[model samples]
Target: MIDSGESAVSDSILFVTHSPQRSGAESVMLDLAAECHRRGMSVSVACPVGPLSESFPPWAVHVEIPHLGRDHGRRTRAGAAWGMARSMVVAARTLRAHRGTAIVANSAHTLPALRLAGVRSVAWLVHDHLVSRKTRVFIGAGRPLLHHVVAVSPTTASALDGLVDHVAVGRLGVDIPDDAPTGALPTGPLRAGTLSVLTPWKGVDVFLEAVARLDDATAVVAGEAFPGDVGYAAQLRERAGHPDLAGRVTFPGRVRAADALAQWTVHVSASIAPEAGPLTAMEAMAAGVPVVATDHGNPRNLLADRRGVLVPPGDPVALADAMSSIAADPHGTAAMVRRAYAHVAEHHDRRETVPALLDLLLGTTSSSAPAAPADAVAAPSRGGGGSR
Candidate 1:
């Protein structure tokens, strides 16, 4: 826990997020907001009313705004722009009302609105790799408005190299209980699973393909699709029913991370696109599940030095091979799991990250602050339900 004795920096801190969904970035925001509140800072969150709102700390203020950003499949480009414009107006009003509160934009979509509001103490927590040219241009244009830019990983920080100066790496962290379930590999037929929202780029399709190659493994794809990606989710369900996957695959809708990890012998992160820093992978490591992640973004760094297995992105054969190797070599898998657990404890523990982020936000730092690493590529820009 961060000390509550420091002198107040801002009267309050307003956390602005574009989407209402409780995905990776939003999850981080919730944790950060809770910590801020714990430290006796006035905390408020502004976002479209949805599941995320329900998850906010009860004491924190909730300011509703129009859904911002492009919902690629569900809305026309012009419609998204109009929605964003309306959101900006609402956000600007909120900024005026909360005059001295430092602003924390949880997604790039909120940047324009913060810029419109003209708040100088803005911190943009970059969660995804911005691959779209238009998003890069828009964020770059608003760069002057951001007082500090912190990324969830070194790879994510690299993406903002020339676009934003003084970009710092603040890696995502997970809660690791002292008695966290850690031990030898489970004794049973291989059970593989992944915890991610159902979306095209997340590659649930690729995961199903890999599951098809595992003759005896039962697999679970545990997450719900947003409104815009229902068609893609349906396609994944249809793919699961094919003869190859047949009764072996299950669509368990969204389960709690701990519940999902507890049921799986092997956890997979099969995103076709590069992920900035996936919380699910980190959680699995902390929970003692062997991880097989795509070789891109933060997974590459997390799984380096044989802490876990890294398969080529979008390659079902490689994914399948990696899964099989884990099941076949329990001895090796257990060693890797132990190494992974230690690595997460030393680096990605929430006990460390949450305070680091609070210090960064409050403009205070202790000897424990993590040093910024060498920057590397722009990440995929996030929006309402696309390109995350």
Candidate 2:
């Protein structure tokens, strides 16, 4: 990462997000982008074309183009490449429009084009671990392009194998109010909350299986179905209605991130697959809600002090037991909330993370320096090509 701490102010920033909707990655992008905009730096977010493109704030600029890669099988390989090319053209044009602007590219997927465009002063923000071949390809491709890399946690940074320029383990923050009212809890039984998109990888089925293990717990499932995965959501709904666990589970569709947090006593993150870092968990913690999450990937690092229970992945019995334990102990639940807040205040506060992230954008703070004495390229790394 190039050390640009020498500079005073960043003129503008182009944040590359893969989605316009509210995913974990997009949540970080929006929060930071809004903050930068608040700080009087011109900030804009560019995302692949989608229905949610209209949701960006009116003051900030928005650009949409074909996805760098297709989601699932929406486009062929050549089509994805072409889409990427189109997105690159838009990105380059956007960068040129706001000359001297910093490009904060989110996700490893955009690395290749950021590289091809030769846009100097780029920060690669790693929102999660890349465990798949396609994801690794993107990471390996973009490792060189980064002036710095921002990871959401130390655990996340450690998992990256030192490929990033500067490894800042900045956690995402939530602006939960201290005086906000905790809404009335359901009178029926022990209510559990889940806030994630309905995708197979997110393990909603696994969550349902856990619900099956609970006789009195009612699980409130939030978030929309992923592209081409509505059927899976239906299956979860149907499964929850089975005689075994029918009255114990319900799907209420998507909830506004803030409003959703206000409605739940506990947050559940049941991802069976590797999650880079989930904003859902962070938000839940910030809202002072105890989370019952899987003990893999980033959650283990975030939820340390028994603030929340950590269960092995793909284990419903464990999840059920943990939920029951939490529901049974109100005092323990309050303690969990306090501990979670303290953890966020001590380590994951956005106040600390955002400025460090800005350092990456300004080229002031980075782990790796620029590659050559050139304007565009940064130093090469072990398993990658030019600077992303």
Candidate 3:
């Protein structure tokens, strides 16, 4: 398929990611890789050995390196840099062996490393809204080699204004299985819950504080702390053990969004900080569960017709009232949930969004290409804290 003169790039793609976790970003990367290979392009992924590495199929090549994680806040700057430097050295050697037409960096962690290795035509997929001064300098230095950037949300895209030369929006997609298990409406005490990684910024604490106020509603919190934030989850458990929260609040710990949504009467997204589009929230909407999300960041981008309830971020009083309201007006909420479910099906389906993501990666979309729908800008919430 290639001419002799054009030897460097030949429809091969190399995907680089930092850690092999079940996070939303990793899910998108694996889904994208599978889609690319299905389209007849050669694809391979290079990541550290961890739980998620096993999820890659036999059709895709997997290259393992030292295990990777986020920079610990308590670690000294020099120490963090040194550890990353060692990982970079090994990753570079692996990259050199797997030549491709374009190299894709799944997160900011891999972009600089690939840049330092002199990899050509590198594409950076912005999963989170990263705009640190240090990150800016590193990306700026590597700007010459960059092909473009694919941000998951408009907020993320807007954040990249001065940081990168070319920017594209990639919305997150959800695959609704025909055989997806259906959940029944609750008949007893109002059971409300949320599925999210337990972190301070994720605002599970806010969810808990609000749940403490609703005497008629029982709450379930699913999701464990990620690698870097175990202490925060421990604190949540300690708080859940408080006498006031006693028998009302439960921590189920790291269940799939589908299972959690099916178990609860209402699904909630109570993040305090801005989040990219969260797949859990999208999946919940797809499953016909009523949603209550904070009115900041990517959630604003998803619920266009006010399908889900929105509350002020960090306000436990407002969040509690929203959850209680959903539990009270089942018939009214069911009518609203139908509209929300239809909105998700029409827009956020993976079948439609994956090709759009590949188009951005392959430089296939042109100026005359159809304008982006609002969903692409708030497509998938690939934020580090929301899923996984």
Best by TM-score: 1
Per-residue lDDT for 4 in model 2?
40
Model 3, 184: alpha-carbon shift in Å?
A: 8.4
Model 1 lDDT, full chain set: 0.79
Every candidate's CA RMSD: 5.0, 6.3, 5.3
Better of 2 and 3 by TM-score: 3
Candidate 2, superposed: residue stretches over 4 Å from native: 1-8, 73-99, 179-188, 363-388
Clashes of each: 7, 15, 6
Residue by residue across 1-388, what tens digits does model 3's lDDT show? 1222232334678788888676788888888898788778887888877767788888878878654445675378888877877777777676666544467778776766666566766777887764776666556655665665788878777676655655778787797656432334667877888888787888999988998898777889887777788889888889888987888888888777777777678888998877788888889888878888999878887765767889999999999899888877777787777777777676777887777776776666534234456666533322322101
**C-alpha lDDT score of every prediction, in listed order:** 0.79, 0.67, 0.74
10 residues in a row with least lDDT, candidate 1: 379-388
User: Model 2 over residues 1-388: C-alpha lDDT tens digits?
Assistant: 2324444456677787655455777767777787688778787777765645666788778765446555455457776666666765665554455435677888676666666566555677767754456667676766655666766655556556545445654555555455532322334567778888898888888888887887767778888886768788889888888898867776778777677766666788999976666778877777777788999877876777676789999888898888887767877677777777776655555655565555555556544232211111123223332232
Clashing pairs for predicted structure model 3, backbone only = 171-379, 172-379, 172-380, 223-254, 277-381, 278-381
Cα-based TM-score, every candidate: 0.90, 0.82, 0.87
Shift of residue 99 alpha carbon in model 2, Å: 6.1
